[model samples]
Each structure stands twice: as structure tokens, then as C-alpha cells.
Target: MPITRRQFLAVAALTVSVREPRAYAADQEQAVFWRAAMPGRNANVLFGYARIDASLVPDIVSDGKRLIDETQRIIAAFPNVEMTAWDLPRRTLPPIWKSISRPVADELRAALAGLPDGVPIEELSGIEVSWLLMGEGQTPPNPYLGDVLARHSRSRGRPVAFLITEKEIREQFWLPRDPIVLNDTIDEPKIAFLLDVRRRVGPIGAHLEQLYRARRGEEIYRFTAEIANQGIPDPSTFIEEEKAGALAFDRLLGLLDSTDAPTAFVVLPIGILTGETGILPRLRARGCTVTPIV
Candidate 1:
């Protein structure tokens, strides 16, 4: 019998153990160790807008695939996902005003008038949201500020899990011919940033390898999600730019005006469980299959 995508996701969920490992002597000793950087220049940044809900997940295939499909949809919709890097400083910005400052209170008081029903606007006062919007298409040397762009990683308890392609490389793009000069400007590293995604269904067999193969030369793909305003873009724009950030944002933009889609992977999440088993049984009943991302 063949497996479906839902089944694969189920297996991924069962096999996946996202618990973070305890700090070892080496990890503790190396306080200054830098995290591994992702491959490629601009096509490595992952921009995900996921809403976390503590409520229990539902079992229907529609619901299970909804999570997977939506996440993937956001990843797909995101244009130039790779080149979209953020240069947030390691240290967070300091609070702008003291708690007792009247000016701050005054601003909050004025802004509180337009409150949503059942929500207290007063709760937001004095709370430094810290989140802010920095524009897109900014040139480098002025590395992106406000947001910290990082590779996607998932957690099981505390330990974070990263996706590794069974094939040597997951995806590929062209690089500059003059390798030495290119290497001089950017600090190139060996390892790449790992994004973590969990499985919602149960385990399966060799299908993961086949999905990996199918992904090797894929030019066009799709992702679906329930959340409407995921803040993602179309793929056509990304293909047109040939990846602006891949070269240099400034130079790349100069060559191409459209800052539409960011070229990158279309990450999605799916599930299929019922009863206490969560989404697992539903996946099996439907004969769905999943791919292993170990």
C-alpha cells in the first residue's frame, strides 16, 4: 500500500523527539561559540509568522494538513526568503521610557481609546512590546535591525531539531565565478542553520527518501495554511529577481527593481490524529504517507 503526505507527517511526528539536550561541559565551556550559518547569501533567511495556540489540536485530515499546509504556504508565499536576512544586534534595545514617565503614560492613555471588545487596553501600558517594523529592501553595511533572522528550528521539550537532507544538498543555486574575492567580503562558514519542524502523524518506511528525491530539482511548489494574513508573497516575483540578495541587495536591486518574492524553501506542517492518539489514526485510516527529514 502507498502512503500519503498526511501519513508521512504522522510518522514524522511519532519518530521526532524535539527535546533539547542538556548542556554538556563543552557547550558550557564554549560560551563564545558561533551558531552555524545557513548556506547561500540571501536565499537562506526564513521568515515565518506562526500563531501559537495552547488548545489541543484536532484530528481531521483537513485540520492536520491545515497546520502543515499553512506553514508551507507561508514559506512558499514568502519571496526571496533566502536573501531576506535581518541584522538584529545580539543585545536587545533598551526600554525607551521609565515606568513613571508621564509622557509615556500620556501616549498610552491617548492610544487606549480605540480598544477591541473584551480586551483591556490598560494592560498594554508600560509594557514594552519591543517588536517593531524595519523596512525591507535595505542595503547591507546597514544590516537589518529590529528583527533577528534565523534558520527554522523545532523543539521537543528543550532540545531543538534541525532538518537534514538525505541527499547531500537540499537545494542549489548559482554562485559568483570569482570565488576568492567573494569569500573575502563575507565570513563563510561550513555548517548551515537548521530549521526544526515537528511531525503530526505516526511513523512510516522508505517514503521519506523518495520525497527527498522529488524535492531535489523542484522548481515550483505549493503550501497551504488556514491563517489568512500570513504576510507571504507570490513566487513569480522571486523567480524574476533571480534572487536579488543572492549577489548584493544594493547591486541586485539595481539590476532588478522588483522586491517581490524571496527565493527559499516552502516549509509546511501537516497532521492526522484522532482520539487520544491525536492525528495519528486519521492519517492511517486515510492511508496517508510522509517523508522523513532526518
Candidate 2:
């Protein structure tokens, strides 16, 4: 069942009113708490999106193991939740951002056949959502899936949201930027999955939003994409593959340096790259919170 915002608030009040710090482990079993509220946000619904962009930034990309460990810690900290944790591979076709360029709507419908039916269309109200994790030289096609998802989301009364950490990747929206590429087409399974999430979360979010609004006496609608298990290899040695990873990382950092929304989540597999440099420290230094998927 969905965790209402009011119930969440009551829990929050209790945590705040407490004074002693709690232990993390219990009975030598890594100390799992029984749905205790985290100090901050109580994310009732956590959708872990699968990421295909496994490349790492040289000297910038952090260790994959560390990323996983930290993320585990984060999840452990959250208490009381309606969590959908699933994992799938990044799309092998055109990249997610460029999925719309090809006549792939039908392709998408087919691709998502095996996914769990967690959300319904009526709940979405016809909103389309988009997802992607790449930027720059590896640009996807225009009128990308983001546009498609937005159109679907707005029209459907459903909110479509993407999970990414790179501010530079999304800069074109808020900044005066040039077209990423005049002509380019890549696999865009991420976009397809985004569309899928829209469909899944549409009904759930719509219902939750309605309930949240009534309980809070205001609008509080936020949709989530529950991601599942993903695997990334070594992420520290990403610079070793500098030719491929560095370019994307450089552009991403550049985008971050120039933008204001510093905090974002990049939902990639933990087994994709190899390296010592992790992406977390860089994000933290920039005041960005890093969330990883196992």
C-alpha cells in the first residue's frame, strides 16, 4: 500500500523529537532497522532506473565498488517505504535520448512487453516521459524522447521523471546552448524504458498525488521510476579508457561548472567500468547527492 504523506510526517515528527543517535547494526546482522525514518526525506517510492552509460571519467570517475557500497548505505538509512527495486540492461538499440528519431514507438511497445505491470495508463492521464544518460559528442537525435515523455506526461495528467546526475547533460534546457549535434543517431533504450516507467508510474503517481494533495491541503505530485538490479564492473580505472569515458565526463563536468542544478542521480550499473576515481566525490564536492543502484 502507498505510504501517505501525513503518515510520513508523523514519523518525521518522531525522529526529529528524538535525541539519541541510533545504532546501524543489530544482533550482528548489519543491524537492519524495522522501517525507521531517515533523518531527512522519507522517499515512499524509490524507482531504480537501469543505466546503459557505463563509461567512466578518467581521474574523475570513482570506484564502482564504493559507489555500490555508498548507495547501499543510503538505502539502509531510509525507513518506511513502498519500494520497487528491479534491474534491466541499458537498451542495445539507439541510445535512450535519441530513441524518438527512429520510428520506434511500436518498437518500444514491444520492448516493454516483459516488464511488470506496476502502473496503469488511466492513472497517467496520457503523459509521456523521457529518459537518457548521455550528453555532447555522443548526442542523440532531436525532438528526443524527453519531448515525447513530457508530451505524454502533460497530456495524461501523469508525471514522467528521469533519474540522472549530470547537470551538464540537461543544460540545453535552461542555458543558451547550441544544438548538441546536427546529425546523429544512437541506441536509445533508455528512452524506451523511460516511456515504460511513465506507463508504470502514471497510475500510481496520479493516485498518490491526489492523496498527497488532499492530506497536505496543497499539491504535492512527484513521480518515481523504480529501478532494479544493474551490474557495473570497476569504475575507478575509467581514465584508462580515457578515449571513450573522458570525453563524456569532461563535457559533463563542463556542463556542471556552468549550470546551477548541481544535484542529480545517475542510475547506471555497478559493473560497467573499472577504476579508482569515483564519480561520487566529484559530485559531493559540487554539492550533488549521488544515488547508485545495485
Candidate 3:
């Protein structure tokens, strides 16, 4: 059953300042990953999605000798390390200073315009107003899956490794800056820019949480291709997903080739491992037998 937002925050130790996104089903061992423990199978991996947590599935952190997560985003959102969390707000003031951009101002205007007047939006900035429309300062129910698993692994004395660095991840998520508009005067991702300053991106985000909780991997790929198909909806679409999965898979391959200890879990985005160009197919192509572990 979908837990309430308060329960979700307590269980996941995370927050998203948005309307309640449905939690994953109550399967204790619910997780997504292909195990290639066939002949010459040197590694054990658990491919994971970023947002859903143990509140939704208790055994999220698969038994791993050592963990290899995809990026530092997982570590950043870790329960022990959330204070350094990113995603700050915008600048500027009223009808005079004009600190925020036109897009922000326009979206804020339209969003407030949708509500009854005398609403007292003077104190709210663009992102704050957007959050007000979306919900509040609490995050959606889906917390960082990779971090949850990582934290669990650490607690169990299991070692952890990162497939990429924070710089690399920042680079991967980096977006070209708009010359005119200055959101914190940095190059904000289109997805982030539109989201942080967007009018109505909450519904699509909520729907995504629904799809993810259902564990319909291939359906997720197709769903993006058909419905909320955009860079904003899912920054890692077909090509990017393939490239990322393949790159991570290759790194795992090399790591396994070098190490004797088996991989405890190989955390990655579900979208990166489901479609034709995803990790599982590539693993199969390499002659390794793939089996669904969790």
C-alpha cells in the first residue's frame, strides 16, 4: 500500500517539497537488477533506480560483497550526508529590483494568476512559489534508492565504490547557460531550470513515481517515448541511457576482471537497464547469462 507522505519521510529520511508521489509496492525484497552469475560469473550486481527507498522495499540493498554505485549523487543524498544537498533558490525582488528572470517571473505570475487573488505572493520567490504550487518544502516520497542501499551496505560493513566522480556527474548533468538569464548565474539544466521555475511539472513527476513503483522497466522506457517524452521528464532518455548503462557495464566488467571479490550490488537507473540498448541486453550479448535476482 502507498504510505502517507509523513510516513514516507520518516522511513526514507528524505524530502522533496512536492505533492505526495506514490510509494513502491510493499514487497520486502523488491529491487531491480540482472545477475550474471553464470559460468565465469565474477560479479554480483543489483541495478537500482535512484528515487524509491527501503520504506517501499526493505531489502533494497542486496547482499553484496562490495557495492559499486553509479555516481556521487547517491552519496550526496545519503542519510549521513544530506546537509550538502544542492538545489538552492533564485534571486531578486519586487516590481523594482527585477532579480529573477522573465521565465521565472512569467511562470510565477501565471501560477499565482491561476489561484484566487489577495493570495499574498509578495514574500514568495519563483522557486518558492513553484514549490507552493507543487506542494511544500518536503520532497516527494521517493528518496534516493542508491543512497539508501549504500547506507545499508555500509551499516552491514560492506565496502562501497563509485563508478563516477562528483565532477563527472556534475559534468554529465551540466547544461549550457543562457546568456541573458542568470539563475544563480550558473548553467542550470533545462530540466532543472524549467522545473525549479516551471508552472506545472508536478503531475508528470508524480506519474513517473507511479511507473517506477510498479517495477515495469520496459514500460518506463516506452512510457517516456510516448507520454512525458522530453529531456525534462527524464534527462536520461534512449541514447543517453544506453551510453550510461554501457559505460557503467564496461566499468563493472573491468572492475570484476581485476578484482576477486564479487560485486554485491551494481546500482543504476532502471531506465538505463531495460530497453534494447540497455545493460542487460549488452550483458547477454557478451555471452553472460542474465537472471533477475531482486
The candidate that achieves the highest lDDT relative to the unseen native structure = 3
Off by over 4 Å in 1: 1-51, 54-62, 65-94, 98-128, 132-294
lDDT of 2 by residue, 33-109 (tens): 11211223221112111111213111112222233222221211112222221121322122332335455555554
Clashes of each: 51, 54, 8
lDDT of 1 at 128: 16
TM-score of 3: 0.52
For 167-209, candidate 1 gives per-residue lDDT tens digits of 2111433221222232222210100000001011111112222
Model 3 lDDT per residue over 1-294, tens place = 111223222312211111111332222323365555535646465464646544554444433212344221221211221112123232232221145556655654654564457555565433233224333222344545555665655656655556654454454533333212322222223323444523344433444455455655655555444323222222121113334444567775565454455445555556556655555656667766667754
What C-alpha lDDT do the candidate models reach, one value each? 0.21, 0.25, 0.42
Candidate 3 deviation (Cα RMSD)? 10.5
TM-score of each: 0.18, 0.19, 0.52
lDDT of 3 at 281: 59
Order of candidate numbers by lDDT, starting with the best: 3, 2, 1
Q: 2 or 3: which has the higher lDDT?
A: 3
